[model samples]
Target: MTMRRHRRLAATLTALVALTAAAGCSSKAKSGDDAGGQGADGVKTGRGVDAKAIQLGVLTDMTGVYATLGKSVTQAQQLYVKQLNAAGGVCGRTVELTIRDHGYDPQKALAGYTELEPKVLGFPQFIGSPFVAAVKQRVDGQDKGLVLPQAWSASLLGSPHIRVIGSTYDIETINAVDFLLKEKGLRKGDKLGHVYFEGDYGENALKGSRYAAEQAGLTVVEQKIKPTDNDMSAQVAALKQAGVKAVVVSAGPRQAASLVGVAAAVKLTVPVIGNNSAFAPQLLATQAGPALERMYYVATPSLPIGADTPVAKKLVADYRAAYPEDALDNGVVAGWSAAQVFGEALKKACADKDLTREGVGKALLTLNAHDAGFGMTHDFSDPQAPSSRQSAIIQPDKSVPGGARVAREPQVSDAAKAFTPGG
Candidate 1:
């Protein structure tokens, strides 16, 4: 990571924060970490089978635009399960994680769900919004069946039967923009432009950005493009023509990279901000060197990057040990986080001598204090209990001070925010 990359990442994070804050309307205070609750399904466990094996499912994009994201998240979750099982299993029962590749498609995700419906106590999905939209009803149909979804669509948050693990784009971008504007000491009524791919992803981001602009008394110039479109010169030129001061990009890595590079080519020097969807290395690779200058991104925990925090260190080591040939990336962190959440839930489910879906859901609701032994600390409790809704800003570096190695370390925000599924 380079300094330019660092700036870019920071800018992007600012936008994400704002979005999360706006969309995360559930005002439930952070209930401190505690255990002992009933599962949603009212099922009970009496150490049923001494050798009972619990199977969890991971559905994600394995070979698509978001391939790395899904793969890394699944891998980390697998490792977490492996470690938990190695440490005597959850509640003395071994956990078996079954991963299904959905290729980021809703149809495939539904198919995967159908395949795992018979045997799974719960399923955690990491597919993009499309897959989530497709199977939204199906997953919720589990009905207090211990469903943990990673997608942050506001619509799904209304389901009390399910658990959503992250912040919504609406709140993330709104909070982020507000913070960044205040930090930068920008004047009131300034224009913040958005160049994004046209879809739910982009529209969601736009909603947040627009809300922030209205609250802060700022102006917005918006442009839409295809996520696969590589030539954003036109969009960049349009933003410049609109005299936009800041630009928020709501697209995947490839599109983001293209837009940023085009901004540089067209000499649009305004600060560039990216939403969570843009979190990954592909953007960095696309806009190396000067192009990365003043580029900032909002990174969720799944992208390990150069995280040296305890959780990150352990994850890195485990990944290296598990897949020595494959270089460590973001997906590993996602998988690890997923496992960490489930592991805690499983433990809570067994806390009161009974393990069941109702117990797991109750445990998750009241569960807090997530210190993954890494730099990551996610505790979810209160009206909205999925605690790991934090987002950090990452600025890549070209070189290190005092001749140290250049690495990517996210500069997390001082302000901690909570995200409720629909609240």
Candidate 2:
């Protein structure tokens, strides 16, 4: 990479790392050849710092459509590592995080992977499904470096080496739809409306919603929107004409925000169900109307809006002390969760005598139905092999009587299992 690109990558990576490092640790933290420690189960250390520091490469979208989200997730990774070290480092070795920006471009994703091939582990955030699919073709059926994916949905398919920290797209969507239907007491033949951007992301959202709708015997009035088109007046008009009562939206913030505005303008107020990608407050806040009033979103971690829960409180406090003026977002929360899982895996990997790629894969496969009581839970046990389909559903208040409040606490289905380390 050029010097400028390398510097840019370093800047983004440092931002994430700095977000989670405990006070006094980053400044006095040991660097280079003196940070090594035990691998699994806190075994005895072999070499000193030089042998202990695990090189972890993080590939994220430093600049792209999901750049903000990617950056958040990367920050979470930073926090995880920082905490791990503060608590005596992972397996007695400090984790050295090296971040590379893929720009949300597929070719760049490939390039990023190639550049990071020499690292001990790869923790990629916001590679998205398309980039994952491309990488999967190359990594599957091959035993090489571990690819810890931060993207959900598409990343679940193919690739044995790339372990996921969240549930599959289909499962998340199906669960969300099911929750909405059951909670609202909706029966079969209920009319529903679907609005989404005409792309892979939107299509994936549609797939989950459709599956749930079919199970509940619901009918959908589907409308597609171009990413460039912001005004959803006509789409709302069509849905209103169809007499749709509930609407499921799967699009970006800009387009989804527009839909919310139009929905209220046309007086199609009922329940607005959205996929995980559409859960940003600013997105709905972009346009006026009651779009977010009863907006229901399906997400895993229920991060308190303003540092309420134990984890959120600690996150806010530590981050403030650490990063100070930096802001936290949903993506960062996801990243933190991902790192939690990876930390567990690393602990396990170091414990096992055979700490190869296959060994780590096996350990992760065994991590089914683990719950992080801080907020969310997951269950990845499958008939086949290791799966990353462990996530829960959370609903955030779009419009509280007084600004955005915690509408609903994070809730996981009975299917989610508690994490049992070395199980």
Per-model TM-score on C-alpha atoms: 0.77, 0.76
lDDT over C-alpha atoms for residue 126 of model 1: 48
For model 1, residues 186-207, the per-residue Cα lDDT tens digits are 4577888887656456677677
Instruction: Give residue 423's error in model 1 in angstroms.
Output: 9.1
For candidate 2, report its TM-score: 0.76
Candidate 2 regions exceeding 4 Å error are 1-50, 124-126, 226-229, 294-296, 299-308, 353-355, 381-423
TM-score of 1: 0.77
Q: Count the backbone clashes (under 3 Å) in each candidate.
A: 60, 20
The per-model lDDT (C-alpha) reads 0.58, 0.57
TM-score winner: 1
